[model samples]
Target: MEVKLHDIGEGMTEAEINCFLVKPGEAVKADDPLVEVQTDKMTAEIPAPRAGIIKEFTVQPGDTVSVGSTLLILEVGEQAGVPVKIEKNLPKPAVAELQAERLQSFAAVKRKRVLASPFTRKIARENGITIENVAGTGPAGRILDEDIYKFMAAAQQKPKLPAQPAPKEPAKRNDKVTSTIPLRGRRKQIAKKMVHSLNTIPHCTHFEEIDVTELITFRNELKDQNQTISATAFFLKALSICLKEFPVFNAELDEEKEAIHLLKDHHIGIAVDTEEGLIVPVIQNIEKKSIRDIHKEMKQLTDKALENMLTVKEITGGTFTISNVGPLGGSFGATPIIQHPQTALVSFHKTKKMPVVTEDDQIVIRSMMNISMSFDHRVADGATAVRFTNRFAELIQNPKMLVLEMV
Candidate 1:
């Protein structure tokens, strides 16, 4: 049987082979994982169709294969008829050693049954740690990346013998040191999307400063009442309201049809920076969800993004995108690029206390934040973008007003 690569995600044309889990001539049960493949968005494992023996691999690690391309060949049932040779008589010592080796191999196979994600297993492999030895604290006893780190930390605490000093060798004059990173996975996908967005969209960014003093005080009051909510959650709610008023910013431009399609469902994507790359996971139906619900889902999605466990459905179908770079401390401003096909993106910067003049001409300290809103110039003009942001700022500055807008 020919085991082929299939489209794992929405319109995924190709994927890079990461590694093979089973070896040639190894016996595998039905639905056992055969190989790991890295798509542009996430990593996935291809499983065997039925109980079979691996015959040969059609593609090696790091090979890029397209949908319907042959990944490997499996010999099932009668097709796996290779004879096994058995010795009738042998020395007792050799026979005993053979039995022991088989037992060890059986134990190794049992260890491979541990539950873990592909990315988690990748961390274990890179650290040269046997995953079975690390105790899992995750649900269903699944091994997590943190478990491997804890194991390594425990091993480091063990005392070691001091090494003997050796004569130093002279440095070579011709040697030059440098490092290189292969841009083939998510990094490559990000680069391609960035280039396409820049080429196809006429981006116009507008910058503004928001007085968040009242919002901070309101949030603290809520916390005192044991109703803690993130500022971004409030921001998303305000943005949803603004999008309802200015639908042009929450739209897509179809050049071929010469039409502007305004989206009603407000699926907002939050840009999360991870170890792999910048990933945006969408929170669906922000117009219908409350601030508390948005906060809970945002935290859950951000956790999944950092662990590289977000699904295709969780990352797609976004009408707008936002980046909260305040925690990263870029306080001044940034020209955030809009997600391709999406009309606008907003980035909130760090908030700081500054002297401000009140309406009564009295000077007081106020918490202020900077925001950069970028929109497609072909879809919406500068004046509209300004109005959209002004409404968002108004809602944020007086967070209690958001309660009236809520369902």
Candidate 2:
């Protein structure tokens, strides 16, 4: 029987196949991971549909499949021949499930059978407490992640606080303290992806500096006329124009397969680092939009990025990406890792004052920003990347191009 891909998250219509863990005719366990599907927003590992031999696999790596799409067929193993229907991972229940669980527990178990997940139960047992004694604070008293944190914090006797120090002797030496930050959520994912990228992809870095004093002056002039426009909005208007002539910057190389994939649209992801680590929300069909539209959408994307309201579609599946760490308060160009598969990423520090001269070689102050870009050596050469970056720098350095775009 063919196991079809189902809607794993709300509003998720499709997913791009990222990797295949099991090959056809491979035997697998009940919950063994089969393939990984990366939607625009997140990556999920599909588990075995049943403990079976994969009879036929329908999807390949990089296929974009919508919900309810056929994914694979399997021939059930003998012992599990009854057909082990693998239930897809589900989000914790909503209001209706909460109410029903509450009703069932109130009348049926009467709080005797503490509703804790398997791992939580293990923690409870290790702490010498029975599941029934945990007293869950989760909906319908279903123990949750936070509940575990609270329990863990309470179980062990914490170290006592030290008294304020008396006058220390001059001989006292400074002592070093070591701290271990716990890995959780996106930070954890970022760590994993970074390691994967650094290990798997053959990467090369390039640096360039462009004087953009003219661009700044032009942006200010435009803003004076159109008070609501933003410099970034104007710059992107110019970027769209450059991309029309050069498409290599808009492509990706599949490292494992050694082939370049062509992206159909210009959806540029601007990497925004928050307390939630790096989230790259995309601006879709950037070339087709005007400066006003780009300005509005950028504002919206930034807000969504801040509030964590961005959907998977909003965050993933872009061919090109630009990351600005300037807003984070840095003003120096820095190296950024290439988001694997995507051939390149453009990054820069906040704009800063630097020394420059006009074509006449007049000594002067210029508005300049350092440009840092990372590229996949397998996909794009340095010359092509430099040309792409220069086009962006040219537009930024000459802001009048923006006015022409709107006209």
For all candidates in order, the CA lDDT equals 0.84, 0.66
Residues 1-407, candidate 2, lDDT per residue (tens digit)? 77777776544677766556556655565666666665534456666666666668798766778888878886673433322333356444654465454344324422233444433443454454544545578778887534655655677733222122245445535854343454533555577667877786677777878776776676677678876776667666776776676777678766578677767688888887654457788899998898789989999998767545566578777777788776665676777887765767777677778777768989788777777888877777889878887887777776776667556
lDDT of each residue in 1-407, candidate 1, tens digit only? 89999988865888888888888767667677889887766677898887666779999988888999999998765323321223668787876676566445434443245667777777776667766688988998988887877888898833221122244456568865443466765677788779989999999999999999889999999999999899999999999999999999889999999999999999999999977678899999999999999999999999988887788799888999999999989889999999989999999999999999989999999999999999999999999988888999999999999999985
Q: How well does candidate 1 match the true structure in TM-score terms?
A: 0.84
> In candidate 1, residue 236 scores what lDDT?
97
What ranges in model 1 sit over 4 Å off?
78-112, 153-177
Cα displacement (Å) at residue 239, model 2:
2.8
Predicted structure 1: lDDT: 0.84
* RMSD to truth, every model: 6.8, 13.1
Regions of candidate 2 where Cα sits further than 4 Å from its true position: 1-177, 255-258, 403-407
Which residue pairs in model 2 clash with each other?
Answer: 40-316, 41-312, 215-397
TM-score of each: 0.84, 0.59
